[model samples]
Every structure is written in structure tokens, then in C-alpha cells.
Target: MTTVTSADGTEIAYDSAGIGPALVLVDGAMCYRAAGPMRPLAALLTSAFTVLTYDRRGRGESGDTQPYAAEREVEDLQAVMRAAGGRAALYAMSSGGALALATAAADPGVTGLVLYEPPFLGGDKEYTARLGELLAAGRRGDAVELFMTTVGVPAPVIAGMRGGPGWSTLEAIAPTLAYDDTLLGDGRVPGELPVSVPMLVVSGTASPAAMQQAAQATAAAFPTAEHRSLAGQTHDVQPDALAPIMIDFLLG
Candidate 1:
């Protein structure tokens, strides 16, 4: 993996591969280069794109700076963009959709966007506040549990997850959850996103009804956006189902 220095001098770790146009994969909450869906997705798309997958700051091999803000993250992606020949399309997963869209809104170098289930399901200040409380109290496991419960994870599953080996990693990155929340700002898709690039907002028909609605609302916010619902897919979208959709839209 190579590294790029963000505006704040934070070192971001990333991997770039393949041979065609550049495409950056942005992970949602609790995901990074080693722990998310991006790797397989990158592998599938590399045949058609020079896919760039990175550890968002504070996760994987990346460095984190103090007083984390969404703008800092935007700069982090821009730093990766510099490595991608100064321009690339973005495929943002879950909360990453907000960060990617914000990046495109700020940098005209972003040529296109493919957002999958951005979780624009409105904001809950109380949830955010409680999450902050749990993390501040140093109850990392509790923080992780709270997030899982909030996201509709069943109690029994979260109980099982607590005893898993990967639970430690989730606890370690619990603080970054707040960073993801910050990018979501009150959580309703922002009005008039100043992004004019061709965009596709996608959701899974198998996802919850609210999530599909959020996907629709997100598409409506972009001037040049199309909405697609993948049959029988859930929030954890299948790479095989998604890769072709991305290749077509990105290369079309």
C-alpha cells in the first residue's frame, strides 16, 4: 500500500490497481481497506478501472489527526485523488456517500459518483449524543453495541458478535463512528448539493423501506442523478451484482 499526505499532514494508506480510468472506493462506518467490502469490489472492477481502495484516516494503516472534521476527510480523499492522476470517479458505500458527494461538490476534479445506500434516513441528535457519551465514557464495547442496535442489529447477534475476534477491531475504531456521523450532518440529504457530475444513487429492494426512501431522496437532491434498486440485495450489497452496474454507469 502507498501513502498520501492530507492537508493536515495525516498519512492516509491506500492501494491503487488495474489499468483504465481511475475510481476511488470510499468505505462507510467501521470499514477500511482490510475490513470492508471494497477489496472484492475493487478486484471485480479493476478489469475496467484503476481502482483505488484506502483506509480512511484512523483505520487500517492510516494516521489520524486531532479534532477530526469532515473537511479533513474530504482533504484526505483529495490527496488520494492526486495519486489517481488528479481526477477520478468515486464509489461511496453507506455513510461514505456523504463524504464522496461533499468531495465532488468541493472539487470539480471528481468526474462521477456511484452512491450505494447512503443512509440518508434523517438525523437523530439524541442518538449522536448518546454515542458520544458511550465513547467518552471509555465503554468501547457499549459504544459498538449501541451502534449495532441503532442500525437494527438484533440483540442476539450483537451478543454473539461481542465474543468474536473482530470485536476488538470494532472497539478500536469506535471513535471514528463519530467522524462518520459528522459527515452526515443532521442526516437528511443536504439540499441543493452543488454537484453537477453524472451520478447514480442505488439501493437494495431487500433493504428496509426507510433505506430505499432515503436512496430515492438522495437521488432527488442531485440535479443529474438516477436511482436504481437492485433485486433481492440488501445493505450488504453483493459485489458481483454491483460491479457490472458500476462498470456500465462509469464507462457509459
Candidate 2:
């Protein structure tokens, strides 16, 4: 593990493997460097590119300086890039994809991006307000459960998960769920993204129709963007299935 100081002086912890061009992985909601699908995917991509997976602020080993803002998270990513020799390619999943896209648009030096199913298409205003209310009231478990339901998790499945092994981790980071909600911000992709930087938006074929549409919309929004659908894949896409596609976009 390694650490870098963000512009705000927060310590961001990360693990890097392999050699060659730097590729940083940004995880989505409820995930950090050590706790998400990125670990397995990073293990596979390490052969072709130096891959860095880090804990976003307020998660895992990373430190959070008070009062959150979405832009601060972008600076957190910039901090990782400086740690990786000043620039790096980014591959982000779920709401992390939204952050990566926003970063790539704002930071021209980011090089490229692989954004997989950002979940940035539709969200109700009133429900979102309720989510914020829940989080601010410190109803972390309810907040987490609300997010799960908002994302279409079946009630029974959510119930099952609550009693299972991963539930605890999910609850622990419940407060950060609001962070993701802020990034989503009404769930609509902007009409335009800064030109010149290359981007690839990917969605799994088996994911909801809206997910694939969001990926396509993302590609359409960027002047230099491509879209792909992984066959037989879902939001929880397997590492073996996703690593090669990311390699093609990030390394090729």
C-alpha cells in the first residue's frame, strides 16, 4: 500500500501492481481500494499496465477532511495521478464512472477514461431529498437500504444481503452513500463533455435497459468517446469478463 496527499491534505491510500503506463481504478458507491470488484480486475490488468486502486476519501484507509463536495473527490483522483508520475488513465465503475467522466472533462491531463455503467440517467428529486434527509439524520442503515432500493435491488434480495457477510461493510460506509448521490445530481448526463480526451463508456448487455442507454448517452455526450456492451454481463460483471475489455480500451 502507498499514500498520497490531496490538495486538501487528505491522505489517500492505494496499492499499485505491475509496470508500464499508470492506470488508476475508481470504485463506485460502497467501495474502496480493498473492498470492491476492482481488486480482482486490477490483478488481471496488472500484467499490461501499472494499476493503482485506491480508497476514495472517507473509505478504507483514506482520510477525509471535513465538509464534502463532489469536486473534492475529483481532486482526490488528481492526487493519485500525481502519485503515479503526474498523469494516468482512469477506469471507473458505477457512480465512480460519473466521477471519472466529470474529472476527464475538467482535467485535460487525465489522458483517457473507461467508464462502466455510471448509473447516471434517472433519479427522482423528492426521493433524492429523502435520501439526503436520511443521511443527515444519521440513519446510516436506512440510508444504505434506501440507496439499494433506489438502484432496483429486489426487496427480498436486500433483506437477504442485510443478514449476510457483506452487509456490515456496506453499512460502515453508509454515510458516504450521500457522496455518490451528490455526484449523480438528478442522474442526467450533461449535453457536452470537454473535447480531445478519449473515453469509453461500457455497459453490460444484461444490465437494465436504462443502463445501456446511459452508456450510449455518455458516448454521445463526449466528442471523443466509444461505447461497448459486454455480452452476458451485468452490473456485477466478473473480473475475467471485464479485464480484457478494459485492457483493450486502456492499454491498446
Q: What is the C-alpha lDDT of each candidate?
A: 0.95, 0.86
Model 1 segments more than 4 A misplaced: none
Q: Which model scores highest in TM-score?
A: 1
What are the per-residue Cα lDDT tens digits for candidate 1 across 91-205?
9999999999999999999999999999988898988999999999999899989989999999999999999999999998999999999999989898567999999999999
Q: Model 2: per-residue lDDT, tens digit, 56-95?
A: 9889999989889989999999889888887889999999
Leading candidate by lDDT: 1
List candidate 2 stretches off by more than 4 Å.
none
Q: Give lDDT: candidate 2, residue 172.
A: 80
Q: Predict model 2's lDDT versus the native.
A: 0.86
TM-scores of all predicted structures: 0.99, 0.95
Q: What is the C-alpha RMSD of each candidate to the true structure, in Å?
A: 0.7, 1.4
